[model samples]
Target chain A: MRRILSSVTDGRGFDILLVSITMIFLLALSGMPLVYNVVMSFQEVDMFNLNTFSRPYAGLENYREVVSQPEFGLILKNTAFFVFGSIAGQFVLGFALAMFFMMRFPFAATIRGVFLVSWVMPGLVVGALWGWILAGDFGVLNAILKGIGVIDSTMFWKSDPRLSIWAVTIANIWLGLAFNMMLLSVGLAAIPRDLYEAAELDGANGWHRFTTMTLPMMRSTIGAVLALGLIYTLQQFDLFPAITEGGPANSSNVAQYWAWQYSFLLFDFAKGATVSVMMLGFVLIASIVYVWSTRHEVRG
Target chain B: MTPQIEIASVDKHYGAYHALKDINLTIPRGAFTALVGPSGCGKSTLLRSIAGLESITSGNLRIAGTEMSGVPPRKRDVAMVFQSYALYPHMNVLGNLTYSLRFKGFNKEQARKKADEVAQVIGLTELLERYPRELSGGQRQRVAMGRAIICEPKAFLFDEPLSNLDAALRVHMRMEIRALHDRLGATSVYVTHDQVEAMTMADHVVVMRAGVIEQQGAPLELYDNPANKFVAGFIGSPAMNFLDATVAEDGRSARLEIAGKPVLPLARTLQPGREVTVGLRPEHLRIDTAAPRLQVPVRVVESTGSLTYSTTETEPELMIVEQGRGRYRAGETLPLTIAPEDIHLFDPTSGTAL
Candidate 1:
């Protein structure tokens, strides 16, 4: 008893004790589920076999079925569009906004904080809000487009096959724009002000300074923002279920939503697990990139 | 010598606070000028104005006899060495030195050739490809200087460039910078709060306080004949000591207000019975019992083998510095004397020379 008490208070015993507690909690909660899903993707899972660990080994059969579906091609294209479109929109607009707010003006911080309102909202709530704004008949966006004479007729955004994926992508961009801008702003602020003055005295114009000094100094930050954006966009599930529901013949369906549809809506648990395991590959790569980029920060 | 940079009635204001007021200075070509002052005294603001980093609210500035009214910092053609060194951490030393040259449309080969020449001049030829984070503080300082030198601008503005280094490095870099200025025959304006650096490095020194130029002249000229008490106290180590006194019956002398009321002759005549402030440099004082001009109890004694520093135990304690170690202990009354010509009298109310 005395040894137990002493071990808890000092030496490697305390370190081992702390590590074991967290390790046990993570293994029981996250690690088991993750391993179970990967195992389920390799087996023939059904409602009858859900309760038991042992299942019939299906091998590559589940992966084959998921890839061979008729809507698979369209969903793959839509997923690529949503991921790249959302990330590109968020990053470009976020960087521009971050640079704009860097000027010395009153209410700058307060106004930038106001920009985070859309991001502060939950994804499902933001999707619902954008759903109304992107509605076919009574949408405010179509009304603005008509009022500005950009379009002569009402345009169906969420229901139209061509525009269904774009509606959700736009809403996701709005949701993540503030996150990107805030992260990039912190990166921009970490740079010393005297560097700009020194560059100015060195005969660098605005464009030259931006390219030579600002861009290179923000390498790690841009990497982190891009890597996280990739992961976040991949895991983006709430918006799909809220706005388009992978509607109009799967034109808006993405990897995460399709995985959910195969598991709960269609009751094809193996195919859902198979689809998610594939996405895990991309997220793992992004995580590695994030860690590596941050480890190599160029700050002096 | 012809003036290289000229400022006429310059003033700077940030909203309601005035930073620099009616400052006029002419920096002659190839002359090294030092702006020395306390913090927030507009010395840095003045230097930045010259660099075009900070815009002057009113007045004309001429560099190389050209008007600089609307010229941006990049177009002003002046290089500044910041106190932080501000080397680009992302770039290697070679990249840093050649960045401005590249902007000026230097081809890759031309830029590399120029970088080589600058690296050789700055003693960083060995570390050309090393990033700033990999270099030590002194090496980074040399990179900043090299970056400034490669451009060969109209003038160089240094904002306390050596303030970040250790004491020994600060002194060594001080001489190296002065030597570089002399060898290049480049016009330079250095700003520092350390008067010793300004005295030793600059041929001309401008002392400023409260947004006003208190005095400007040769380093020793300002040291020997300060226009005001502020300049007098600011321009020397250990600082000049001030004591309140009443002029004696004779207009040429004044009696000290300490315990002994010891009397000393003034350098210049003052009205008899006038209240004046006596300014005596600490180094000018000595222990002279035979001709005792001051009798005060010592408060503290410090010895550094080559010098003795003592403070008197009085309301406004006076500091006395003497060459070499002389026995001095706390609570001991010490008699001191000063030559009549070494005495400085000031008008007590205005803090100006009498």
Candidate 2:
């Protein structure tokens, strides 16, 4: 009896030690950035001054000053257009492509393999390639347009302030398409063939089956894709910097680039952290709404 | 209304593998025809082909005198109850039943009215507003049936609709399906591997083997006179027992010699000295003390509440189903008798009845 009790205690001790180690690793992973961000956003700091590690709270002044900037509203609007436009475009095109590939067609596997290349390519590489392609002079697009006699001469594609947002939006759409397509494709494949057969027997044609069966079955995947797309697009900085650099006259400046400008370019870390915190808040609220609306679809 | 579904020399292939071969069958109007076979026997494939879920490689199919060869499943006017129930997870029970009707051009009011009628018939009126996830397995099955029945299509296709339920629920649902068929009198094609379900619910059972029809007949006809040994073995529970035998000099009756001791008589005509297989159902074997037909040593004894099963090993292993009680112990020799009328003889080379 004593031996058995001791062995049981030994087993429980190992379990407790394992749980403690896991909790320590989790705290190191999740708690570090949260604590750093909270501290930096609340403190008055600058790039030139190294006081972020030891600064005191400035009581929402940083947030107030950040919001009082002239370009804040414009940046917010550009961020909204970039995120919403890119996500919407990716979803529509990606879902359509996914459905197309889902059908029984020849060389579908080869086509899918080709489509996946864009997703596996690095974001920097994609931005650089699009940057060269959208260049005003000696660009393939302008050359084609001129060759087709659609335009008299090469136009300033990325330099024009009016078309800069669209230029950035197009690049982001291309980058995100393959991700959405792969996710929605897996979701579509998981649906049983019997459901489609049953629906067909129930007087549902191809369109009806897609709307009722495919759409509902892919709801959770759509939600995940949309949420991730929204979050990534809202925090987008790499592609814009490489492609347009938030020009002409900051027409394509998103929240993340604006925040980077404040911190690194303008040397106001407090205001940049303030912008970051605000963007994070918006993302959290949007995510919460997305999760709440899609709760039933997820469970079902 | 007479139900009429006909398939003429339908052929279907998947790459090099022939999933279905030169299949021809006619399900009479208002008849419940069951496609019964083991898994991968193309029973479901045949049902799907009839439902137009699968395209036929060749030949013609018709329902209600209209060609169904190129028609889609929806236009074929047939409703299928999938094995998984396939209830729309997002929709409530009422929504599931009414969703298809809207596409069929039924107005919202008419669809709702039809859904209500179906709900009442299936005893799912209370669960109509609830979602599929909220319902039990049996309730979901009823909802699936209700979804199919609400369409009032020309024929109903049931693809192992009750296989998901537990044994007790399956039995209950089987009876319910039979009653539903009797009342609706719909031309139904049901696919199931379980012979009991086919035997109980089907007006005609089409036994398929390797994508070909082995036999097609009424349940009792198939039981009483099997066309082949596969049907004989497949139809009954505990399965029919087979032993090597030779035709006697009389030609009409054959001698089934077991363990070189007990020789049983089978009522079938065969060439004398010809090797044949003798089949006997477990229920036909009885425990006799005085006039024992065949004796064998008991191997295993299983006692259920109603009936007892004693598995015996003679020259060939056999299962003996007896009523009430079994006094035989393991390794104990017991006398087993089968009535000559119940005996079945099949050609050893080809599994065909003599």
Candidate 3:
């Protein structure tokens, strides 16, 4: 009787142990920042009164305040411009590079090796290098422009409100081009050589082959690259912070940078949490739309 | 219409390796010529060169009296069916057939009409609306044929088109292709490693080995009179068996001695005491019990419904094909007889037919 009782206790203990381990793994995975952000977005907490151990609830008040801010509207608009502008430049340049690589040329391998270097570098390092290159005073670009007599005087690149957005966009485009090029190059190579042979037999010249064969065959690849680009560009914060610091009177500030400023720098925890929550919502909506548009391609 | 294709002294090289060497062929118009050889024999390369897919290193290919040295595949007015079918995955069967027509300046209605006509001919009219992935292997094969025929190109090039099908389907498709050729009377150059396909489908067969043409003639001509031992061994099913022998004096006949048994009076006129190889086909050997016969110990026996093949352990291992049920048992000494006229004699040194 005692042995039977002991075995029952041991089985119960084993079940409890398995349940605990599984719960820990799940909390680490899907329960970390996503749930924390949700909980904190509804909590009422001030910067000075912040206690890491405290529990508080505000019930949508933070969300309401965040939406009512005047800067929030401008931040949203700037984010849109940054995402779309960066993605467009990256795709165009990347696609061109991919096409160039596809040609049968000497030193093609060497060129691919050189292009891969930029993508492999840390994003922080890329931002820092571009920041120096785009600096207004004593920068190489301004010096070269002045020396060549293209411009009469040195122009401030980061400080000027009109040019700051363009400078940031240029930096992001350079950093993002490598990704698009590599992916599209793979797509181009995956197409069967026989298709091209067949198309040529069908009387398709260079332009006809490109429009009818190359473009249509690359539809799934293009859709995948564009969708990924949109998502990655939407959450962009590193380049703006490292290079421009959302500076020149906040003219180039994106939503992610704004969220970081409210949460970390300003110590307005409630409002910062609200901003983070809104950014999450925006990302989810964009991803959902992208998936819906490319469902057929994904299935294929 | 006599649409002759002549490839004169054509040579192709890939870097340092010579792919094709001095290949010369004449394919008469409306004749179905098959290039038959093992893989890497440059048969497909030669076919692609004819289709203008690969540029020849030297020499000229003339189709209907026009030199096609610098012509591209599109301007050559020839169509090709690849082994993989190479159908456009995104397009349905109808779209696949009409894709080339659009580039040829045919309007949508006209292209569809032509596609439908070819689809009916290839028995793919019911499958026009289905995608390539949705169709079975045989259906996709028919669609590929439809795509090639819809353009009505001057010549058709097939690179092992029926290789991907099952054995039964391959046989069925082979007959379909033959029927299609009869109806269209299109000049075609087909490449395959299967000797049966070459013998059955080709009006003329070109046997190749090591980047050179061993022999080229009508199928029956090659079977009856192979120029060399290589052609003789490669052109027949169950392959011709060769035995070492020496010619008898007076140059009238050859004597082949196998397993201490004298099988003499082989019909050949060679110098006396000259070494030679005697060739025999399995079907020519008959199992006889009446008169004096060449005795052979049977090694293995395979019985099909129509014929029985028995392998014998002689000087050169021989395969014997007999009609109907064969009463010969394994491990038994069987008496076999060969007709005097059915013998093929070859020179021992040069391996050429005497």
Instruction: Give the alpha-carbon lDDT of every model.
Output: 0.92, 0.86, 0.85
- The model with the greatest lDDT is 1
TM-score of chain A, model number 3: 0.82
Categorize the docking of model 3: medium
Native contacts recovered by candidate 1, as a share? Answer: 0.88
Better of 1 and 2 by DockQ: 1
Candidate 1 lDDT, A56-153, residue by residue in tens: 99999999998999998888899889989999999999999999999989999999999999888999999999999999899999999999999998
Q: Which stretches of candidate 1 lie over 4 Å from their true place?
A: A1-7
Q: What is the DockQ (computed on Cα atoms) for candidate 2?
A: 0.66
Compared with the true structure, model 3 gives a TM-score of 0.90
Candidate 1, backbone clash total? 0
RMSD of 1: 1.5
The lowest-lDDT stretch of 10 consecutive residues in candidate 3 chain B is B260-269
Each candidate's fnat, listed in order, reads: 0.88, 0.81, 0.70
Chain A TM-score values for every predicted structure, listed in order: 0.95, 0.86, 0.82
Rank by DockQ, descending?
Answer: 1, 2, 3
Across B146-189, the per-residue lDDT of candidate 2 in tens digits comes to: 99999888888999998899999999999999899889978899
Name the weakest run of 10 consecutive residues (lDDT summed) in model 1 chain B.
Answer: B258-267
Ranking the candidates on TM-score from highest down gives: 1, 2, 3
